[model samples]
Target: MHQPTVQDFQSLKRILRYVKGTKHHGLPIIPGDSQLCTYTDADWASDTSDRKSITGHFTFMGPNLISWFIKEQVTVAKSSTEAEYRALSAATSETIWLRHLSAKLRLEQNIPTTIYCDNISAIAIAKNPVFHGRTKHIEID
Candidate 1:
């Protein structure tokens, strides 16, 4: 921002506090199945300025985290369904990349990796591509 405000400083302080609290936190890779697991979510219209949702996803290889991300949706979502669908799409793309990376490493993952989502409507949209009435607003590309 061109000019920082008190609110911005407060937010910065909060972030620093969180970082301090988690200073010793670490990701642990334990012995487990070689299955890939992914979890995704979206907070519908969470951004006060843009009314856009924040999408987040975390992916795991066996018991270790391999990939994760949090992004603000560029387009404002019309509903929770749309927001969740966007999140799902992002998570799916990341899963594809992880699958390719695993193959390159000769750790060929088993087919049909699991992607978990809390939104039922997003799952439905992903399963039935022909039902475009609810997702017509989303660009095909």
Candidate 2:
């Protein structure tokens, strides 16, 4: 692992302090409302660095937050469609893990969970089992 720089240590301390100061910021998840669902979104080409973007996702058990994550895309996207697809895929992988964990804990999701995205093209690509000629480049699993 890389050694932590002074700035890195300061950032970590600041984050810890923020967490300590805002203990009630996070919502409590209740198990019974298994209407669990997840949503993920991203701003494509939002960052200058490597032209990478930011992804934000959240999982909910009814109205309560069960899990959330925000991350940067590793690859630069040639188009917004690709960027959105990548972000949704990343969030999907995480939600799948969360689903399994919830099942193990006896709080298994009872209904089909829908992952909502504002991008219609992304949604179409995801839902369509067959890849058309235009989406042949997309390697969504």
Question: Model 1: what TM-score?
Answer: 0.78
Q: Which ranges of candidate 2 are over 4 A from the true structure?
A: 1-25, 28-32
Cα deviation in Å at residue 112, candidate 1? 0.9
Name model 1 segments beyond 4 Å from true.
1-25, 139-141
Candidate 2 lDDT over residue span 70-102, tens digit each: 888777777787777877888789888888888
lDDT by residue (tens digit), candidate 1, 80-99: 98999899999999999988
TM-score for all predictions?
Answer: 0.78, 0.74
The backbone clash count of each candidate, in order, is 0, 0
